[model samples]
Target: MTALPRRGFLTLAGALALGVTGCQLSDPRITGGPTAPPPRPTPTPVPDIPGLEAALRHESDLAALGKQALAAADRLQLGAGQRAALGWMSRDHGVHLTALLAPHPAERPTSPPTPGPRFTPRPEPTSSATLAAAARDGAIRDLTGRLDAALVDYRASARGSRGQMALLWGSLAAYARAAQVALVRDAPRPDPLVVPVRELEPWSDAEAEQQVLRQMHALVYGYQAAIPWFRRPESQTAYDLLVHWRDLRDRVTRLLRDRGQTAPAAEAAYALPVQPTDRNTAAELLWRMEAAFIPFAGAWLAAATEDESRRMAAEALEEAARLCLEWGGPMTTWPGWPG
Candidate 1:
């Protein structure tokens, strides 16, 4: 299936990211042209997220300690198979945590609500929050077991289906754990289905394409997470980074095509049918919208005084941050923009 046109995809993504709206924001200057460039790195801006620096330090410490435990386990000369299993298990935990720490930025809106459809509301907060709140440090450790189980199942799956399936299960498991962490961390927990209007159902081809787009998005998110954070933002540096990211997505998509997958469709409607001036304005418009959406969700997540909201926010941010980081990488799968 062909990928959804870029602007439409972004529209959906923006809606998800903002947890609101459906209007398209294509600019007139887009020429639908493709350019080839090398992958460059963006100077990492200090995050505007509240307490982000401290959180990073805390995350770093935990990761270091986790690695140490895994190393020690290996030094004990545990049975090779057991050691291998544990190693994978440990890696899974790290991945899960990273995923939690940084999440996907693009969002898939839920199907629109049917006319007068029945909706079941979630129950009030439980005592678990109190317990978890008291044991914040240990909460993540406890959640690891869920991921471990999912990871084992994922690893044991048949090879052909494993990658995609592993991705799905792993994503859900990781998000769940992250949510648990958020609850303990006191982040907001707005209802997952809070969008005012119902989702619009698309064709089956659109769904298939959506999956591909998400996969491509995942590659970008991974890159963002793996790269060292940059702090400088000179034009030469910015352009170089943009070129690098642009090329990285094209390269990855090509690899996927060689493996028999089709690259995602470009945002056709957003692109100009012919050359026009002011392309930079068009690009900036989309980026600004995307930038705005991320923080909108963050605001929503940060607002809840209830335990559930806090937990949900923590979980959502983990994935959102991870995904953003991945996109920031040099190997992201989206061709046009650096971010």
Candidate 2:
């Protein structure tokens, strides 16, 4: 290299400094890459079931009925608490309708069902009629009927659906079942089953079955540990729950054997988040164990294939949610899919 003059040397140094400082060291963008905003992601298409539109319509109608009942409750001066009780259906049914309409939002009716212009209440002469029994054109009865009908639609929709759709309908059915139980304490409870028709993730039916079986075993064990620690009534409740879980475990075991899958052996004891030192602690432990089923049952519902199995799973999920309340868990909008 030849020696350069002072001006040339200064210019060359300046050029080098510019090259070093002015250029970005960042990774170069690909020829047609992230420079332009990524094409707006196309939303994944939701699955459409055969009877889903009907389910959506039913939810709309159910929501309307709930609104009317709420209005009637307000008209009768049923108090803030009673008004709140009547309001859940109005809110919950909106969620039900949205889930049903997810596959094709356009199918939503232009004019959704509406509560009529005015509310009418027929208070009994005895002044003893509970809000539940009030006859506003048998509005309470109609509300009950709508919930029952929605359950029917949810079940039918689950049958026609697969994967996530099945799970969605099954969850809705379970929640409806819970609402029915809440309304009428004598509503039929869920029983064990051979299997059901769907699951959200594409897992083996046997795999899901085994999971619930193992969890049920642990729950039964947990209930047994807690029963002795609870107070009189709660102790009885705990005992009853233990019995149910024990029986469910046996049923699950038999099902697994019938399917030729090796049933998992229960541990001598389970490690739990809560320890049963006293009544409150025991109850808390038991509550958590039961609450675990809400989500677990939803996962199982995703894989259930037969109608009976689906019903069993759905009801199990609902039962778990109800039990959580009994065990002093706070109210949650969505139990299985908890926030």
Candidate 3:
């Protein structure tokens, strides 16, 4: 994959100023000059996260690339659906860049503002195949690699951060993973699939609900297998996984009952996608389980009619994405898409 060139852009900040003046009383009768107002408390400064600035720049570059890709797609006259999807993904990148660039309360202004360069837009491709080739060979590969780097940066930032910033950076990393998946799905692949495409098609509402139940049951079994590995005192990741999987199981159970269906009983044992010999392997296997659940979650999202059901499915999709990252799975572009 070709390396993305660094493009510099200006970092801007907004400032607020306050002015106060004391006035002398004209009358001697006034007991004393107006008492000075109590001093305003100063806000505690937020600490800087190392490499966060570089990560933000990288994300901004990604967003610029997305814009260029969208422009190329338009010039190439891609299908409306493809165009729309690309547009949405590009816009998402823009939003992420804005969030990353927004001034934090703890950020101090630079004396001499630094101006960054803009991305140079490439000429439009003449054919759809050319476009796909560019995406497959260039943009998608670059994005996946950069997303991995950005995830590392965000994880580091989260460690040094407190309160909402910590949560925000962590969530941003997950979003980057999802964006990587979207780019991969949009790109063309050379190989034929072993699994038939028809099998990946979206199911009817009833079918989707059933699939969700099956997935929930499988996850319950998978987590049960994983719990022993996570039972070590130092295994916070394992504990988190246990809690998440169990909560998902219960949520799915409630969903099933709400639909007037009985949730399937957990199996005595579930077949592992890959047999685990150690903690690392167990974590990998659990990650695969979550990856497998994504499609079902997507299907449920599509088939759900009620707002609550849809929200639940959305939450499931996001959680699965986050867990996949936690377990070192490659970023997926479309976790909720049936395809």
lDDT, candidates in the order shown: 0.32, 0.58, 0.54
Q: Rank the candidates by TM-score, best first.
A: 2, 3, 1
Candidate 1 lDDT tens digits, 1-339? 122223222211112222345556674564556676557666434233232233233323333433443455434333443333333333333333332233221122223222222221212222321213123235335435433443344323211122222222323333333333332232222212122322223223223333334333433332232223333343334355445445644653564476576666443233222121243332332232222223222332323233333333333333433333222211111111112
Clashes of each: 39, 14, 8
Query: 1-339 in candidate 3: lDDT tens per residue?
Result: 111111011111222233545666864564667698678677445445566565656556665655666677645445444444455555545444444443441222212122223222222222221223254345456546766777777656645554334334544555666555545544322111122111234455556666777777777677667766654652666767667777877877777787788676666666677566678767777767776776666556556655566556656766776665466454433344332
| Clashing residue pairs in candidate 3 (N, C-alpha, C atoms within 3 angstroms) | 8-116, 8-117, 9-116, 9-117, 10-116, 181-332, 181-333, 182-333
lDDT of 2 at 335: 46
Q: Give the TM-score of each candidate.
A: 0.28, 0.62, 0.45
In the range 202-310, model 2's lDDT, one tens digit per residue, is 4577787777777787788778888888788878878888888787778778877987998887878777757779987887776667756566666677677766666
RMSD of each: 23.3, 19.9, 19.2
lDDT of model 3, residue 57: 66
lDDT of 3: 0.54
- Candidate 1: residue 315 lDDT (0-100): 39
Best-to-worst lDDT order: 2, 3, 1
Query: By the lDDT metric, which is better: model 1 or model 2?
Result: 2
Worst 10 residues of 2 by lDDT: 7-16
